[model samples]
Target: MSDGIDDAKRALRAELRERRQLLSDQARTTAEEGVHRQLDALLARTDVRSISCFLSTPTEPGTRSFVNAAIERGIRVLLPVTRIDGLLDWTVATPDGDVTDGLFGLPEPVGELLGPIAVNDVDLLVIPAAAVDHRGMRLGWGRGYFDKTLGSMERCPPVYAVIYDSELIDEVPRDVHDQPVSGVVTPTQTIVLSPQRH
Candidate 1:
């Protein structure tokens, strides 16, 4: 990653984080519901029996409702648990599962700790992103956790980033280690982008 592109990504992530923080309560509610619908729509198109997803922070597009609903539907949902080794552990999401702040203060489920490779069996992946460009490039929050997970997968499933409608932009700065998603699920719609090859 060039210093120029890295700097651009840092600035863009900050702006996107600020935008999320500024959302009104009503707007957040609506966006949360919209996210639920879009996620359901994504599931309708894919034949996933199990999936991997992140638990969103309050400011991010909400996924908690959908997680509960999926659990009710008997789908195995793996929630990411951050490990200190720069890899993610996993836990099965239960209805009303206990959540504690993991590394970087991200919400993580508390349960049986599955090893890092547990994600490999998931039929789909719904991850978080600061922004996703039209061509599927994902700009994360600089931790590189999701990027590394995707990169290490032997046969990655259809990965999608959850973002607000406006965060879907024309382009985003990228580096060699950045992993492209197969699509994006926004409050308004689900867009399939051509995933880039490393």
Candidate 2:
């Protein structure tokens, strides 16, 4: 049974990877615009003091607009920095500043590592996922980065996994280490789930 489940997950991941790669430039732009609009709405509803988000990559759903908007709102913006111990550390970033490339070529803020902030200090956490289920289970890029990071947090923040609308699924294969999200923000809508169930 386990083997069959693993096989199914592998196949699904491959198919989704292909689809992500085939996204046309125009489609990518439209998706990004939609994400920005949703994020704007979220920001307006919440009195977020600080946010932790990622820098965008071509294949990954981008968060540049969200980060910029946070900066413009005078909200403290934090980005993840890869530690030598293979852990993700949070650091503050400016609107127009340089960032350094880290694991998997992900860009991170170029500044003093504020180290791990109190998870409660982060009002919102923008998570990156390849796909997410209606139950809020996230299928990451299989790096286990976010899983490990969240596990280490003293008090986990409200996590919002960002994805394209089409990437939302009814269910997903999950392991013991997989952490569920509090909500999911898609290009089309925001689906809130019960708190994280590890």
Candidate 3:
């Protein structure tokens, strides 16, 4: 039933995408502000000096605001730059850092290109997700970038997936290659999940 699972994931992702796109500007702004506050609080509770975060797309849960805030707070925030080889290169986020469209049209921060291994040194990893299950399985946007990164890390730190509050559901379609997150940061709350990773 792998095909069944894949089909379900695709269908769910499409619906989630449409739902996010339909959000009003005001509603989106409020959600973004909530996300920023939650992320700030997560940092306050942890010793996350260096972090790896994604530059959010328009319809995604806004991490750009949190990235900027982290920079202002003097926390080292690394943003992912997509690589054609299915690995990720990273760059340090700067105040007002310019971003350009990279592979898959994802907005990647423009700065000194650090290699894929750079993420290994981070205290925490804040990644993008379409949705995360209560058990912490992350349904990404049809890309295995984060899964590959997480699976390869030697001493992986706490990895958190950022999603909207409504996206936290009881269950999501999962596959053998799927990776489970340590927690999820939503617009409303930061829910720590327990799932043993392979």
Any idea how many clashes model 1 has? 0
Q: Please state the error at residue 187 of candidate 3 in Å.
A: 1.1
Candidate 2 structure quality by residue, lDDT tens digits, 115-161? 76534478888888888888888888776788888877787778988
* Candidate ranking (lDDT, best to worst): 1, 3, 2
Deviation of model 2 at 92, angstroms: 0.6
Top of the candidates by TM-score: 1
Per-residue lDDT over 1-198 for candidate 3, one digit per residue giving the tens place of the 0 to 100 score = 388999999999999999999998988888889999999999999967999999988888888888988999999999999888999999999987999999888788899998999999999999999999989999998879999999889999999999998999989899988899999998899999997675
**Model 3's TM-score against the true structure:** 0.97
Candidate 1 or 3, higher TM-score? 1
Candidate 2 achieves a global lDDT of 0.79
Better of 2 and 3 by lDDT: 3
Model 1 residue 193 lDDT?
A: 94
Which runs of model 2 end up more than 4 angstroms from their true locations? 1-7, 118-120
The better candidate by TM-score, 2 or 3, is: 3
lDDT of 1 by residue, 87-191 (tens): 989999999899998988878999999899999999999999999998899999998999999999999999999999999999999999999999999999999
